[model samples]
Target: MTELLLVATGLRKSYGQTAALDNADFSIRPGEVVAVMGPSGSGKSTLLHCLAGIVRPDGGQVRYRHRELSEMSDAERSALRRDEFGFVFQFGQLVPELTCVENVALPLRLNGVKRKEAERRATEWLDRLEVTEVSAKRPGEVSGGQGQRVAVARALVTGPRVVFADEPTGALDSLNGERVMELLTAAARDTRAAVVLVTHEARVAAYSDREVVVRDGRARDLEHAA
Candidate 1:
């Protein structure tokens, strides 16, 4: 069996009277791609945020390598997020002023890598994602697909253990979305990183090795649901 890299047990969260997660249990193995699918407001994004340590659950625990995230200090959790996780969002979220290579190198720079070395590594990822031609272009200067490819390159440049993507291809057309999923999964696989993908589209979820469906603040394995 593959080693488990992340686990969430009996997670619970709420915003006022609305529950975002209710006793949710989920796990991810190293190098596995797991998709979270559900209707909007069903708490899929909340689950992803909890798993990524961006938001602490009101109850239960999120463990990464046996260390409970809820027990960590804010600074410790922040460091863990920066060192161990990557993220891709629907809008790509690349800096408007930074060129493609610069955007990709930002994470490495945050981790204390020298600019020259970071750019070199960033260029390699850009080439891998087939966005090398856009290396000198700013985010606003490129097509949506090209910008997204650059975002993927950025997310993986730091060699994180996990990638948490929320509707990563939501803003793209079918053809572009397909291409992004292919590259994202391929890159994560190549780097031996687990991916927790949150998407509403079945076509996007199909890229994952396993699927979990969220409904009414609960999550269940798709296979188990059948």
Candidate 2:
């Protein structure tokens, strides 16, 4: 079996009196798309955040490629996120001022890649995502599906080892959502990057290689469940 690229065990987090996660465990291998499925407020997003190092767990540990997220300093965690992880949110979240290509290139530029080179790669990703026509348009000028595709391009331009997508298709209609999932999963597979996809929709989850169901603050990896 392929070695696990990320693992979280006994994870616990709470908001005041409410527990977001209770001893949740998750694992993903390289090049795999693992759907984290659950209804709203089921802690699926919380699990994704903890795995991506965006939010630290109140208890337990998250390990990525042999390094512990909780043990890393804030700067270290930030650096790790910038270099090794990518994220896509429900809203696409592109900067309205920058063109789509620029948005896609932002992560590379942050990593010190030069302007021309960064945009060249960014344009390439946009083409691959089938949103090349919107390259020169700002986020606000494009359709929702196009904007989301640009977001996916941005997430992949950094060539991150893992991508954390929380409700990636939530803002779009079914047709657009299906197209986005197809492109996202295909691109991820081609790059051999693991994906942590959080969604409540079964149709979206069908794109994944494995499923982990989160319900009432607990996670159950269906593939490993008895």
Task: Indicate which candidate wins on lDDT.
Answer: 2
TM-score of 2: 0.98
Give the alpha carbon lDDT tens digit for every residue of 1-226 in model 2: 8888999988999999999999898999999999999888989999999999999999999999999998999999999999999989999489999999999999999999999999999999999999999999999999999999999999999999999999999999999999999999999999999999999999999999989999988998754333
C-alpha lDDT of all candidate models, in order: 0.92, 0.93
TM-scores for all predictions: 0.96, 0.98
Q: Largest TM-score belongs to which candidate?
A: 2
Stretches of candidate 2 exceeding 4 Å from the true structure:
222-226
lDDT (C-alpha) at residue 113 in model 1:
97
Error of 1 at 97 (Å): 1.4
Candidate 1 weakest lDDT stretch, 10 residues: 217-226
Model 1 scores a C-alpha lDDT of 0.92
Residue 44 of model 1 has an lDDT of 98
Instruction: Tell me how far the alpha carbon of residue 130 in candidate 2 is from the true structure, in angstroms, after superposition.
Output: 0.5
